[model samples]
Target: MFTTTAGKPLRYNHWRKSYFDSAVSAAGLADVTPHDLRAPHGTWVADRYGVMTAAHRLGTRTRA
Candidate 1:
């Protein structure tokens, strides 16, 4: 759900190259992809909310 400076939707390849890659490199991280942030983001949400909330945020289905 990222957008370009002009407010157009950002394509994945462009975002990966122009934003994600640059940010990771600037942060001194290597070999990290956007998908790699999921686990930590889920944990952060779950800690403050709950597993179900995290699941919803992550678009994951959970058996009840």
Candidate 2:
């Protein structure tokens, strides 16, 4: 689970872009956003199983 510096569980809140940009740059991932982390897992699962099954396992509802 994510937490703040004050030792409280991180609930809903927006983080600054500079914060994410610095982390990404430090990790040496160029042009990567926080949201990009999910794409590889999603694609791997979907390709291995199926789109519908992967969506269900991911707890996401998809029409197709």
Candidate 3:
């Protein structure tokens, strides 16, 4: 249900740091970016659980 201000459906790669920077400023978060959040999420899940668990959370199947 995500859409841009232009009323177009939001796609993952469409937004860049400039877009996120504006959003973060509007939201008044001290400092955070998309890459900052995504990396640790992957690392934490994989480190604590395993690759298979991470893949499952991301809706991918473990292959033989």
Task: Highest lDDT: give the candidate number.
Answer: 1
Question: Which residue pairs does candidate 2 place in steric collision?
Answer: none
How displaced is residue 1 in candidate 2, in Å?
Answer: 5.3
Q: Please write out the lDDT profile of model 2 over residues 1-64, one tens digit for every residue.
A: 7777887776543343637777888888798866686778878999999888778877798674
**Whole-model Cα lDDT per candidate?**
0.95, 0.75, 0.77
Worst 10-residue lDDT window for candidate 3 reads 12-21
* Poorly placed runs, candidate 1 (over 4 Å): 6-8
TM-score of each: 0.82, 0.45, 0.38
Q: What does each candidate score in C-alpha RMSD?
A: 1.8, 4.0, 4.9
lDDT score of residue 29 within candidate 1: 94
User: In terms of TM-score, how similar is model 3 to the real structure?
Assistant: 0.38
In model 1, where is the ten-residue run with the lowest total lDDT?
A: 1-10
**Judged by TM-score relative to the true structure, which candidate is superior, 2 or 3?**
2
Clashes of 2: 0
Of 1 and 2, the candidate ahead on TM-score is 1
Q: Of the pair 1 and 2, which is ahead by lDDT?
A: 1
Model 3 lDDT tens row, 29-50: 8578686776678778989999
